[model samples]
Target: MNEQEKVKFFEEFNNGLHRLGRITLIAASLLLIAVPFMIGILNDVSPSGTGFLSGFAKVGIIYIPVAIVEFLVYAPMLGVGGSYLSFLTGNVTNMKIPCAMNARDIAETEVGTPENEIISTISVATSAIVTTLVIVVGVILLVPLQPVLQNEALLPAFNNVVPALFGALGLKYFAKSPKIACIPLLLMALLCIFVPAAINQTSLLLLPSGGLALAIGYVLFTKDKL
Candidate 1:
């Protein structure tokens, strides 16, 4: 074949591969909605108002605020979750969140337009949903295999995926204001390392201890004499 024919042939091949990739992606996306429902039926998961999924749904359905409160109370430091995933995978794709610490900070970063905001949200949510779906699908896929334990293998991968994504989102935020960012973060790490044990006896105590530590640190830092 001539050079032009060779180039044309390769271009067509590339287009075919791209089309196949899109088809697979679409199938995977559709499975996200279906798989969870299938799992519910197969497992006979119900509105027990208890157990993991049910209890979460019950709490969410009755009192949406509580879920928000819980998330806020237990939220981790900047990108640490993503960083953990990066550690696990030894891959930078773990840092795929692309969300900054908050909207205000994100707005100040390079991606500071309405279009960018949309992109940022899409990027972060895509990473999160993909990570979550991977775990669910992994567990489901392994169910028939019985003893090989593919689900166990998935846990570390998903765990690493979380922090890696978070880290990626906060990368720009980290660069913009390093010192301002590190204060609460350092305190959180210290508490995570030292106080989880003391708070383990009581779920409510954990929140208060963390809140107190954060409040104390803020106050100390704000004080002129300190």
Candidate 2:
């Protein structure tokens, strides 16, 4: 097809994707909200209006900002379909982002291009499917494997899983540009060391750390240091 035709096709594809994404997100949200109410109805018990509102407000205060930050930060990297899938499936940081980044790198696709978008979506979808299957198997095996999972010998490895995954994924990129990576890494490390609570607020820390990295990269680019 011609360039113009291809562009038109992509536009149409993205529009349809957005429409479906919105519909699914809305439906999923409604179902989530409805589940508790449905259970309350079945049990003939309901929370007080004030209690529900107060509880929701408390949780929302903590999570709402994180949700907005994640969407803003990850959407460009994940593209349309991937963002939708990742948000719906959860585990954006430890699973979807890694899968999408690995797929993009392996496919040699630049971000924001149609190729990257399709690859990201496919990778995220595959990750979601695999994660679902793993969860199902884990549930089935939970009783049988309880002793193994609860073993003190494996506790450290289980606790370090996320750090290990991110460390390995980040090492390659950090090696590529130690100059750009150093300041942000050092700043974050110091913050976590001095303010231990910051470690629990990973989503909030992403904003300043990411902004610092970008600013440093831009400066280095202008100075021809990158």
Q: For each candidate, what is the lDDT?
A: 0.51, 0.91
Write candidate 1's Cα lDDT for 1-226 as tens digits. Answer: 7778866775675466457646765676688668877887999974343456755554454356654553454223212233223222222332443343343255554432333433444444455667778989998997888765456876787668856885886587656545444654565567667987743443344344445545655666788423
Model 1 superposed RMSD (Cα): 14.3
For candidate 1, report its TM-score: 0.30
Q: How well is each residue in 123-217 modelled by candidate 2, as lDDT tens digits? A: 99999999899999989988888899899999999999999998997898899989999999999999999999999987678778877988999
Error of 2 at 201 (Å): 18
Clash-forming residue pairs, model 2: none
Superposed on all Cα atoms, the candidates' RMSDs to the truth, in angstroms, are 14.3, 7.3
TM-score (C-alpha, index-matched) for candidate 2: 0.63
Error of 2 at 139 (Å): 1.7
Off by over 4 Å in 1: 1-110, 145-200, 224-226
Clashes of each: 9, 0
